[model samples]
Target chain A: MTTSDSSPTVRTPLYNLHVELGAKMVPFAGYDMPVSYPLGVLGEHNHTREKAGLFDVSHMGQAYLTGPDHDTCAAALEALVPGAVLTLGKGRIRYTQLLNSDGGIIDDLMVTRLVDDEDDGRLFLVVNAGCKHGDYAHIAAHLPAGIHLEPIEDRALVALQGPGAAEMFATICPEASEMGFMTAIRTDINGVDCWISRCGYTGEDGYEISVPEPQAEEFARLLLAHEAVEAIGLGARDSLRLESGLCLYGHDIDTTTSPVEADLMFSIAKRRREEGGFPGYGRVRSEIENGPKRIRVGIVPQTRAPAREGTEIQSNGETVGVITSGGFGPTYGGPIAMGYVSPEFSSPGCEVDLIVRGKTMPAKIAAMPFVEQRYYRKPKV
Target chain B: MSNIKYTEDHEYIRVDGDIATVGITDFAQSQLGDVVFVELPEVGASFEQGEDAAVVESVKAASEIYAPVSGEIVEVNTALEDEPTGVNSDPMGNGWFMKIKLSKASELDELMDEDAYKALVASQS
Candidate 1:
């Protein structure tokens, strides 16, 4: 194995900034990312939960799908996904999946009807880091003639996540404080124009800001200047999302797993499920009505040792499922994981054993968000 | 205080009579990051020099702790079962991984001493 050449690891605009702060650079998703700073993963995880942690997610793909009008674009997107795109209100983002014809999930992505420019017909999308190349190709090939796919490789995505993240942003962009969960605004941040969205994978009341690549270093520097802001990495990112019950692309949801099997039915609007017309509509609607054969659920280890990815799940000495993601959830103060299991043993209280190093460790099927989600929302007046 | 001996796989051994204490060097722990779990050997397990003895698990990856010298497992560090970060926080002192009853005292000559080990780590880094 060759160690990464520090000079040629596909430097993002903030590459030098990360090095200056003493980040442990590791190759991830085709880019050199700071897996942790001098504080280490445990410190970074606890920092994100207690205060705020700034993540340089510039490697993740951001794109815009444009068409003649709202109906036109929504129609174009609905043809590729199973979610009801038309129902998404301006400024609202929906967590949905891209599906193959056979009902397998191509990727799980976030789609938003651009807050102020919905009439002109553009849907903003944030895709996974590992699946961006394939997702872009898949979208470009399937889009209608008038609809165009624009990959925003020249942008930087920063996630400011924690309980104090909203307050930290309120100082820079007061309007951000009013943006409820899943809402977003395209506005100037610290005098540099950017988009601030009230959403994150960490399950905290935070924001994901999209800034021009050139201004990424400046934006990251400003955020780190805040007393509460620290830099986090892919290690903590995985741990945080796992604790939040969020599904990661290429793991929890994949080319062989449908949204129904992943227990993401909440993402499918009532109208979309009732009147199926999206891609993989027939199979997905059928699975929704007649429950999926296997469902994704949470597993809590009875022992301190974690059941990591690829661990076999068994019931009564019979193999029933496989663990997709698992590890120590620093925030929950114990080990937590998510995996697909037979529908018969998918209940929250069902008992199963995770085969760790050939030993059967007792585990229980538990409700997700192993910890409570802490998303910010508007106060009802 | 005890004189430390280094193994090729990065583990450090300190032998005093028949009992030998084992731990990873500071350089090794720094590279491993914050260790989350340590699977120590069961007391009385026999192993040859260079055999897989214990297992150290960091948040990012898992690595095998090799036997620096052949011996009978005498006492494993039970505290590391719940506090693996001790390996990172104090690798040489409280973080010692295991103790073994040395089968051959001459094996110590095969390991590097403090001055030679320092030179080795510096050359690698």
Candidate 2:
């Protein structure tokens, strides 16, 4: 998204590092972000799947919620989202969406239950860069009297992702090696105080490190010094997430889209479903049972031409839906897209036509993650 | 040797008699990042100057390639269909998108020469 010229662009602690590496910087979410490095988007993308790629995600909002105990804090957050936050185990993370009263997603975020006894009644949150301001306001307004939400503005976030990510992170903090998917721990990295999570948006086995702003650059440099780690930009991040079939905040899932319609029903915990008290619970539950009018699905075009965002989708000469995110999948070696279509037309192998620049290109509804997810989970005892 | 000319939109044309070969400039390809696919007009297709003639898609975004001059397409580079990266590796050679039988050879006078095109590129950056 383009920012108005009047508003000064914000820079993360690693901004200078990106410039030193000769990255192509562009405006994104009111910040001057690195879109790609000198290695190019395709090269950077392939490197991440084969090695570890470090991404500066400092633009995201990190916050803490404190209350009397776990129950009080969980109830405060539960009032804003439909996820089973109250039942989240200590040191564990849950993926959920903040919804408006109408059941539309305000933002998708990661909620972690802290383990420290001193912060026994606290929860940690990481929200999207663009929606963080509005999300923080919403949380603060609905917060109960005892519970307080504090935005951690002095911290910077970075994601080390791909197959080699865990190994690289292990070399820095060995204790992180034992963490399973959707888990978090607070540990020091080379003397830098940090909060590390064994989770990422790329659908790969990775870690997201939250370091204080002062030590962020030094910490990033330490990770980049590792042979398996290379600097990645937003360009590769988008492609990697697309290949993983994960939803982008404003694109694939937005305020106009519900979790069920966006195919994110898995995030709705069984307990929340049975006892519905969350926002848009009635509409979401109804859609979960009877199905929504339209649902998001993976689209594979039969031609070399890519059907980009806003491309219209039609079936048998009648328009059914539109593409929300589409691009040439470097990993897929061809064009891949995701879009919304009527429930009757969302089944895999169903043929549809993508009206690209007024030409109808043959496409089919396909199962997502177009690539297999490689998340690492500990074996159950 | 053919006479070469350039357009402000970063397209280049190599003219030999009334036939002209067209492709995007090196500057355009660099700005486009990695070229993954190219949608070209078929042989014998007709287009007017500034009309949308082709689409070049990179891993990052899709861009429109416009007709540099009015003409009828005489040949298309089928090689790019398989090796789209040719646009990034050899934009001026095998990356040529199409050849057109110019409807008016005088249209070449309106295009920029090598020196003028280089200056335009310099001003842009």
Q: List CA RMSD, all candidates.
A: 2.4, 1.2
Q: Which of the CAPRI classes, incorrect, acceptable, medium or high, describes model 1?
A: medium
Give the top-scoring candidate (DockQ): 2
Q: List the residue pairs that clash in candidate 1.
A: none
Q: How many clashes in each structure? A: 0, 0
What are the runs in model 2 whose C-alpha is more than 4 Å off? A1-6
Model 2 lDDT tens row, A276-338? 888899899899889998999999999999898899999889999999999988888889999
Whole-model Cα lDDT per candidate? 0.88, 0.92
Top-lDDT candidate index:
2
Reference-based TM-score, model 1: 0.95
Could you tell me every candidate's TM-score relative to the true structure?
Answer: 0.95, 0.98
Which 10 successive residues of model 2 chain A have the least lDDT summed?
Answer: A1-10
